[model samples]
Target: MEKFTTLTGVAAPLPIVNVDTDMIIPKQFLKTIKRTGLGTSLFYEQRYHEDGSENPDFVLNQPAYRDAKILVAGDNFGCGSSREHAPWALKDFGITCVISTSFADIFYNNCFKNGILPIIVSAEELEKLLDDASRGANATLTVDLERQEIKGPDGGTIRFDIDPFRKHCLINGLDDIGLTMQKAEAIAGFEGRMGEARPWV
Candidate 1:
């Protein structure tokens, strides 16, 4: 996973509620376990029509938001099955941070593991973010993980809370495997001792 320290980029506004994992990547795109190519299929149903044409009405298809690195969405974002691919697709699509009024617990946790920052803010704050995101190409937002702050284009700042441990992991680019690798020496030593102590077994 890539490290997520500070990210400043255009924020795309997605004001829909209950955006589940299926709506994110769709069931059709789940065949591959690899994460790299999933970005093209992100929001497959909403972003593309049945004929496989790009939906002009979709926020991601709009020219201004095509490269958006941040997403300001409505309440209850990421609320469905716990597929880790959701975050993988979002990350691959260049979304480094997701700001919403609320998020499903499992999806929220999945974001950190995949190097995406899922932010929870008050309803009032979300409205402010939505307003900022409505600025089209100018909807740039700066997220400072170290400071736990989101600075909007107009100079307004919003503070968000995050678990310290998760914060540490993201800053250090440590995924689950990366975290375990931190104790490689200890693990190796334990394995060596066990082999010597119970060689017959």
Candidate 2:
């Protein structure tokens, strides 16, 4: 996982509600456990037509938003399923953060685990951000994790709250495995002691 301190990048706006995990990557793309290539398949159904051609009308298909690293979406985003692949797809697609009025619990937590910041703000604030994202590639927004604020294009700032522990984890780039590895010496010592005490048992 990568460290997330402060990010300023283009934001893609997707105002559709109830954007479930399935819609994010689609189940067909889940066969691969690897993370890198999933970006191409992110939002496969909506982004591409049945002929596998790009849907020019899609926000991501637009030239300006093609490289967007931030996403401003509608309420109940990431609503269905608990697949971690959803976040993998989002991160792979260059989205470092997702801002919405609300998010599904499992998907929200999964985003943190995958190094993607999922932000929750008021509907009023989200509308403003969404409007900013309408600018396409020019919709660059600044996210300050330390101060918990999001700066919009119009010089407006919105404050958000996050769990201190999660904030610490993201800042330090520590995942579950990374957290456990922090006690590597202790774990090794415990194994050594156990082996010595229970030899031949």
Segments of candidate 2 deviating more than 4 angstroms: none
Point out the worst 10-residue segment of candidate 2 by lDDT. Answer: 129-138
The per-model lDDT (C-alpha) reads 0.94, 0.93
lDDT (tens digit, per residue) of candidate 2 on 1-201: 799999999999999999999999889888888978899999999899999899999999999999999999999999988988999999988999999999999999998889999999999999899899999767989999999999988888999999999999999999999999999999999999999999886
lDDT of 1 at 136: 95
Candidate that would win on lDDT: 1
Against the true structure, whose TM-score is highest? 1
lDDT for predicted candidate 1 compared with the true structure: 0.94
Residue-by-residue lDDT tens digits, candidate 1, 1-201: 788899999999999999999999888788889989999999998898999999999999999999999999989999999998999999999998999989999999999988999999999999999999999999999999999999999999999999999999999999999999999999999999999999986
TM-score, cand. 1 vs. native: 0.98
